[model samples]
Target: MITAAVLAALAMACAMGAWRLTFAKWPWRAPRAAILLWQSLGVTWGLASVGALLAYALEPYGGGVVYGLHAFVDSAVSFGTGHGLLKPYDLPRVSALIAGLTLLAVLVTVLLAAGVQTLRARRRHRVLLALIAHEDPGVPGVRVVDHPGAAAYCLPGLMGSEVVVSAGTLSLLHPDELTAVLAHEAAHARERHDLVLLPFTALNWALPWLSVVRNAHSSVALLVEMAADDRARRYCSPRRLATALLRFGTAGAVPAPDGALGASGEHVMARVNRLVKPGPTFPRHARVSVITFSILLSASAPLLWIYPA
Candidate 1:
């Protein structure tokens, strides 16, 4: 039970830290590293929370969570034969076991459900695009949809991902700006940013009462955009990207379609400002320290779960 208490406390701390991180400015300087930290925090919190309940519930079986669970299961299997018998579970322990299992089930169910919904939406959009969109020689690999509203997004897929731009965006942006926008969308497709957002979406659905989860979702999303911008800068000058973002912000741009990654979505003005007056890069030592700590923190959850108590 002491180990369970410690795991619960760790989960609480992670939750509080996630909430505070949403407002921190350091993430803007090293969005990639910050994203890693965010993922670690979220994973650790979930693992520790579930581990706490299971640890407490299985405490009477001795050893750690895994061994205790194995012992419990073995005893249950041999109950009728009166072989490998263990003491019966009290009401509190039984309740804790059920609750832990239920929570685990809910998390897994929501995660899978979110993935399926996203896949279905993407498939629908892909079919629609195939029928209505046409390739433009000027843009090479990009598909141009004949729409008046400014739009730029990527439909990520396993076979082949595609970047799409509306006719209005082509009309509004200069050639260099167009290149930057395409690069931005390409970064999203190449990096599979949609996958990064999936767990957070599932977490939010599973735990809507926790405002921290919602804030983390929004913050991670903005970081993903910033990370994509960083990648886009590798292909085109920041100035061109900044101008394109400004146009998108001011031109009443259409939001990205469902299950698609947008080039000019999620705090466009903030992205533009970032490009216009870029901040100092995070120190290498600081980034290394953060990454190392995050990895250790994530590892701790499983270690705690399996360590003999």
Candidate 2:
């Protein structure tokens, strides 16, 4: 009933915020918290859907909610498995469960497809790279490819992951600048930003026409880059990192290799601007509050159905 409307409203709010964030640069002011918020938004949408369905199913039942819920679940189980006929009052729960189950399956399938697609693309790139790339001990933990253009990206895998920089890029940057680039790529690999990007990829696949899907992907991608920049800035000079990005920006978008995240994948100007005019980081309390809100918001949806008390 009312909770169903509340769930729908929360989902819409998250979607609207995601769409608006795509056009806004305020999130970069505190990249870590922003990334967490994006994650929460994604989780909130899925949970709210389930909650809405549950609230709708429960709306027709009154008195002895505990016993009604038991009957509802029993009916749902029987309907789902084709075992028994449902009482008219129990039909809503059975239908709701079926819809919720279908939604869950589709979500899971999309994510699995995205992950497989990414891994396959990366495997193909890695195979091609093995033939043309050479190991450069100078960079320590990365590989160097003698390509014409300046493209730097990381290939992550189950056994081993490789961070690759083109020869043109190596020759273009100063020593410190090169390290900054490495640090940024390393951050991506270390944090498994690929996994973080997976849900957005799935969303885009499942909802190609929805602007919210595209906006969420774009916003999430930039946040990942900004998070990496912050990590690199910890060990390297912010100016050096900014310089590398500026240089990469001039080198033109070296389209991040398929399935891999490149140093300059679109948002080059926004990233450079951020480094140039460093934004204020989220304070300790502020970060805690953001995280707390995310946890509660995400939990609210599931809690409404599971433990309504």
Candidate 3:
């Protein structure tokens, strides 16, 4: 029971931390590291919550949750008594076990469902693109759509990724701006940003009413765009990308297709500001500290399950 309480406290703390981190400005400077922290908090919250329930369920069987669970299951299967597992099972413990397993199943089911849905959406969009979009001699690898609205995005696929731009985008931007947009979209493909955003998307879909989930999804989405922008910066000047983003923002360009990552998606102004007037990135010490904390946080839930009270 003590272990269960500690695990529950840790889960609540993670949720509070996530809520606070959503409003922090430091993350904008170190998007990648911030993303790691967010992922850690989310995963830890889920694991610890489930661990707390399991701990409560297996408390009568001595040992830790992991060992006790094993003993309990073995006793149930073998109809033998050992490791203090001979005690009659109570209603509360059985209920806790059922609840914990249900929650775990729900989480896994939603995540997998989200992934499948997203893949299907991407595939449908890709097929649509194939029928209407065409290749340009000048933009060798890119697919050019004849739509009048300005848009640029990448479709991530198992076979190969596609970077796409609209006709209006070709006419609206200068050559340098176009290059920057292409670089940004290419970065999304190279880095597989879609996968990075998948978990948050799943969480959001699973718990749409939770503000923390929405914040996590929104913040992570913004961070992904910023990360892609950083990668694009390696190829072109920051001003070029910033200007292109500004154009996209002002033009009210059509957003990328569902399940696709756009160059100018989510909080475009903030991304441009970061690129135009760069802020200080996380220092080596701070970066190391964040990485270490993330590792510890992720491991804490499992450790609680394995170690006796």
Candidate 4:
């Protein structure tokens, strides 16, 4: 049974990882649309994992490490009493101490990781602001910074929103192309893609072993970029957006900070491919199947948690 449980957990982990990589690599015509798809997948995966964990924990031999620790503590206490190292009155104190230490260890680890990520984000934001302030001056309501490579981005923040472009990027494209690029970044800011990614970001930090969470994040990021591209397309031509993306991508510019939207290497070929030959629309039946799958997954959560293995 234990072997079965271990294998099940391993399978779930592997499946999630594979899906994450697959979706992350899939090309999309619109980045924002891709992001939404990834978000849906991430949410579903997270819910399923949590449900499975709960189910496993409920089994007789479940809660593996935690239960083992508890049993070990109890045995140790009993042994100590038999050997005269501990008094009967001290039993409660020892148990409380063990539980408290365990809980503290877990909490501290989580908090420390969260704090590090927060600090890194803040530092990146500060550097971005300084870069923007120095490079693009006197642009009202938008601040543009310069990267060493070719790219454009908008970093959405509470008080210091910024738009960034690279020197190589400025030299590579025409004014119309730049406009389309800027518009895409603006769309990302307006739509709050960063906020949308927060949940998955937290998951990635908390559960780094689950590569699915990271894949979901990258996929969603690419999708959000594409979605912004789609919005830009409404204002400009697809050709213009495509041109900008290609030029920026080829220039080899690294994207801006964590929150900004910029062209990524992973999706560059896919984006170009999308521009050249878009796929046919999904049939009604396919759409229905997708919706049905989502609903069924959601409805199965409770059942997954309660059913005996």
Candidate 5:
């Protein structure tokens, strides 16, 4: 019975995580703060799922299954009754210890997951920033560095990567259009899209079975780009930006560095399409729904413990 409950809980947690990650409306326009929150929830859900899986594996009837097994076990082990898994004499100390250990485990898991990722990101940022600083010279506010590659990239940090606009790209875009391109790259650096993406990417890599996480990551990626585009539009004419996107699409300049933010090859067409046909405004209700769902999912494990089935 414990095993069945654990499995059901695991399934529920996974489903909930998936939905929270992937079900956003107007995903591209979502605020940076909101994306951060979504990624945090995803990490929390993944952690809870891991805990539930551990519980399931440790449960008895490890290799056997029976219908209504969980209910039977729960009935047989009713906590206040003499027939329960914890007898009156065993209840106090054992239950207290188990509860204490579970709390500790949860704390350790959250810290480990978040700490490891934070440390790695800090290390990578330090290394990447030093490399970019050494390689590129700059002008205040905005300056373009010439690099001989098929790649377009914006390095973003305290000492951000010099916006590397390839020579081929200069010929492809008109002057005002080029400004839009630069603005887009600047927006990426300013918003720190890479940092925002880190947790979601980690979740996707860690929990590949959750297709919803991958979808969420993809959606977030697309949205971040759009959000950057919107920022670019604020400085440059949207028509010029749209034209630049078209030209860049035609020029086929690939994105530089696995880590840099730019309209990478994979999503160039989608981006151009969006530029040409921008979507309707994101609704407040959609944001509320997404946030509400995330809150419920994040609370699920604790809720289950409080009101055990």
Candidate 6:
């Protein structure tokens, strides 16, 4: 079926081309668009993976995978709705259904597992924050630990998110630079960047050997830092943010704490370059077109199920 072929092709392309898609220079001008496109790619890649397997199993469907699936579902629904008799599925159909359902269930299980693990990590880090970190009224809700290195990161939760920084890190920056750093860290917590990265993390767990998963994980991580930078930029000067990055980030290397994301969490050089270069605005039409393409391509997998082959 065209749908099956398309899904296969999409999976292959994503597996092969995710790096180019995520690391393109054009995204600098359209960070939000790039974020959407990346999110869509991550979601569709998983679905396409399962759909591609089901496509092979449904080979016995003369009208192609989608057609047989469509007809089978129609029959099941008809029987359930009491509009028709329940026709027993043939062995091949039963096998295909079981295989398809199993794959889908596995995908779901992976996602849920990723979510649970991330939450557990966040909870543990939050416990550490409460125990070792002290609340500073000057910084308001932020937690400051008396560590030697200049580090700033956040433990995110729905109600009890904590923005953490080292006391030595505080000593290294000007007040404005500190403000910029806090804004950047807050952006991570406020926007819930970890959740955005979760699906890719799950994919990587599911397919650790796949280069696309590794590339996507790192690329999405960098893009999220950029996204946080974009948020920080709204509150502070890019120069100050870049300056903070230079001193606290480069030599100091304030690493992201366990399960928590950091200001300098990914693509340090690339992120610094972005802050320093401050590239020109990308054309609105180009961003729109790319976003549209991403949406349609991501939607195609599900749409395939909606339409018959």
**Which number leads on lDDT?**
1
Winner on TM-score between 3 and 5 is 3
Error of 1 at 229 (Å): 0.6
Better of 5 and 6 by TM-score: 6
Candidate 1: C-alpha lDDT: 0.91
What TM-score do all the candidates reach, one by one? 0.96, 0.87, 0.93, 0.62, 0.61, 0.85
Residue clash pairs of candidate 2: none
Angstrom error at residue 119, model 4: 6.5
Model 6 lDDT-worst window of ten: 85-94
Clashes of each: 0, 0, 0, 9, 3, 0
What are the runs in model 2 whose C-alpha is more than 4 Å off? 58-73, 76-84, 87-98
lDDT of 5 by residue, 50-81 (tens): 44443433234232222123443564578557
Q: For candidate 2, which ten residues in a row score worst on lDDT?
A: 59-68
Clashing pairs in 4: 30-226, 31-223, 31-224, 31-226, 31-227, 32-223, 32-226, 32-227, 35-223
Report how far off residue 204 is in candidate 3 (Å).
0.7
Alpha-carbon lDDT, every model: 0.91, 0.80, 0.90, 0.58, 0.59, 0.78
Best by TM-score: 1
Ranking by TM-score: 1, 3, 2, 6, 4, 5
lDDT of 2 at 117: 91
Question: Residue 298 CA error for candidate 2 (Å)?
Answer: 1.8
* Candidate 1 segments exceeding 4 Å error: 80-88
lDDT of model 3 at residue 241?
94
| Best-to-worst ranking by lDDT | 1, 3, 2, 6, 5, 4
**Which pairs clash (backbone N, Cα, C closer than 3 Å) in model 6?**
none
